[model samples]
Target: MTNSLKNLTSILLLLFLAPIVIATIQTPLVTQTQLPEEKKKEETPIVYAAQLESSPIATEITEPKKAFVYFTHYQEAYQPILAAKGEKVAVYHPESNITTFQEQINAQFAFHQVETEFLENYNKQEIKEYNTIRPFVLNALGHNKYDIILDIHRDSMKADVTTLKVGEESYAKFIFVIGGEHENYRWNEQLANNLSDQLNKLVPGISRGVLVKSGKGVDGVYNQDLAKNLLVVELGGVDNNEQEINRSIAILAKAISNMFFQPIAS
Candidate 1:
């Protein structure tokens, strides 16, 4: 055979073999035996929003830091929640109903002086209660020398997907909502931003998102008053089971503990 013919034949042979050779080169299969030791995490329990205490990590994070939390709940249906969670209620007058008592009541708020340094330092404390949010906060602030005032409320939303999952159980997720329509809009949004960021980071998708609500129903403008570092947290909604809501709080306690003690910004 001519040298040119031999060269052409060799080239053709190489081209044909290339396809077969390429087929064998593949990523090593990650077989069952080769899989990592980490087991798949269990799904979170799906339960009611009102019963958010299913997660036990709740109290581990709350360290009596001159903080006061006020909930805008109807007097008739909230005591059980208060008792189960080991939360204290500073009712103005035990004889009178909280929701029915229209007159504004005030109290001083604070933690023990030794631990007072952990409390927030308010630049101003001129609280006015012409609306819903203020009265509840004023009452709490009256009794404790608290720099941080949190106005709490329950949410109401359809729960097709709002159901939050964390470490083998599903619970109603808490949404930190702020209303931009109010005067202290930026500060309010910042607090909500901090909370939502932490919850979603530690347990992805547990936060519904920061809502800038406007209009009448979202009343209290949402208590963005009292101080710059106010928190308005919506525990859970009607669609969420009570247990789920409780667990969300438990997760929240961990987040709160981190915010106060571990300043590693979520």
Candidate 2:
């Protein structure tokens, strides 16, 4: 009686314990299989947060500064270039004039990521030409804001006064002419001084210096009274060829960019 009872009890105990042991092992296996999926869910927000942090970089892009360039004495031409074209004039030409510098200026400014707007139209009447261009300049200033306004011109002087040699290259020298008659002329003078300093720093002696004109028979205001940022730039004399002038333009554009834009990291 005792043996039969012992065997039956042992068999029943084994059947019950077998199911419990199998259930415990299978539960751990299910958890192990699901761990990767659970970890992926937990890490989803971190990946999304990284993308959000980087998204603002696209929107943080800065716009370039703007410059307005216009020619008051647009008919002023280089003698060497005009002579090559069979023109007899030493300083003045109806076409092939100082206004042609606008192309090189625009290209150099673009390379530095500075935007330039040039106004080249003007009347043929050399007398009171600044008066004729004033309305157009005022109109341009009204429509758009400019960091600087340049009235590009050519000097009537000889090449000795307007050309500079830096290292081995010859550069057409420039001078900043600001009228001192106006009430706010000092501001224009300061701007000219800053630009002249930058130019000379880039290419030693490239800038002849800032000239202030205010007296009778000198067009004392030179239309600079209209804006604090306006000034006349005597680019070169009649003798400087296109190559020298173009090199100077590149230096000037770089100076302008250095003044207005953020410095690039080394």
Candidate 3:
């Protein structure tokens, strides 16, 4: 009887322990495997966010260069265009003058992402035009910083000296005049030389080279003392018509864009 009782108790204990072991194996312990994968998914977005923050496009922004265009001799006119309209004077016109070039210049500069401001209205009655325009230019400079300042003028010389012909197209030639009297004249000369080189590279012989004037009977300073980059550009002469002058303005705009605004390759 004692042996039978002991055997029965052992059988009952084995049957109870077997179901617990089976249940533990059948139900998977997924927490250990799934935790690492969840962490990896969470870290991926953080790494991608860091990469975007360090990108050059996100960090850097460059603004377009600004140029100021003015005319000391606003009435300077083209002879051919004047004659066509039956006007008497070849060099001067009250209404139709070099100031009209502001439209063309602004249009061309806009294409190259350059901002331009024109000081068109000034006292015309003053005999000393350069002196009259000086105050206005100084005031403009005081208010805003200009990268380039141009005093556009027309030469008294004829077409042969002021025109360039490339194939069938005629272009008005450019002459960069620097004042030799100023203390900072060399800096202005260097700027002129750089532009001359750039212009010639675009269209050979389009520039007549830089000319320095300083002695008596000339406005030696040409108001260039106000700013180092201020330059007097004699665009064409009395003989160059509207079409030629327009072509030259377009070329000049491109040269300015390339020299000052374009980025250099390493």
Candidate 4:
């Protein structure tokens, strides 16, 4: 070969070799920079919605049972019924007493009997707890072989509208708000209907109605399918006192207890 042709070939070889060395040297640095971007992704926030059976933990609890539970107090929707009728606003005050059942309701209401009992039994201690209700629910399921989870809460609305007379006694009306998307959705409705009917007879106007929320929302399902019987019941509004709420609790608890434990009609 001629000298000029050999030189041209050498130049071509150098050009190709230079890019490979440069890329090889830079590869480790490029990978190091990616770590921060990955860490940032880890910190990104996530929005939770229903029909979420994706997590590895989701498939662990699947069985049959009734769970009674309560949410940590998250709002001031119920303020009037907290303190005396004419007294100052202790609405946001710490709930020191009134555990198990509301005073009036405990005098009457009982929780539904179930294999999976979800009652926090905080007994009016505090409502705004964190991730406190369900861990116990899981444990209760373990202890008693329970399957469903029901967390109870009161509705928030104007007091004058909520307070009404039932026979000679005072009672607050309630609406059974059930999430519309759970597998047990229909059964939940049936439970609500049965309870509503029974309460209507036991304490009229205590049931506002059964509200089914089918749209996208957090409460449409309160982790009901740990078993198919899970449900959350919003008994009374905040304007109604624990005492007035108790009137409805009696029949409410009985309805729940009976449904959970009784034999299904054939």
Clashing residue pairs in all predictions, respectively, total 35, 0, 0, 27
Q: What are the RMSDs of all candidates, in order? A: 10.7, 17.8, 18.7, 20.6
Name the runs in model 2 displaced over 4 angstroms: 1-62, 120-128, 262-266
Assess candidate 4 and give its lDDT: 0.54
lDDT of 3 at 3: 93
Kindly list the per-residue Cα lDDT of model 1 for residues 97-143, writing each as its tens digit. 22221211111111111122211232112322326445555555556
Give the C-alpha miss distance for residue 87 in model 4, angstroms.
Answer: 7.5
Among all windows of 10 consecutive residues in model 3, the one with the lowest summed lDDT is 46-55
Error of 4 at 156 (Å): 0.8
Which residue runs does candidate 3 get wrong by more than 4 Å?
1-62, 264-266
Error of 1 at 261 (Å): 1.7
Models 1 onward score TM values of 0.55, 0.72, 0.74, 0.55
Q: What is candidate 2's CA lDDT for residue 40?
A: 91
The count of backbone overlaps in candidate 1 is: 35
- lDDT tens readout by residue for model 4, 61-107: 23334444545453433455444544455534444222335333322
Instruction: Please give the lDDT score for candidate 1.
Output: 0.53
| lDDT per residue (tens digit) for residues 1-266 in model 2 | 99999999999999989988999887865657788999898854211011111111122215677889988877788988887888785677777998766767777776666788987455556533888788888888888998899998989889889998654568789999888888999999999998897787677778999999988888788888878999899998988988788777877877887777746558
Model 4 stretches astray by more than 4 angstroms: 1-69, 74-78, 85-91, 96-132, 146-149, 257-266
What is the C-alpha local distance difference test score of each model? 0.53, 0.78, 0.81, 0.54
- Deviation of model 1 at 95, angstroms: 15
lDDT of 3 at 149: 92
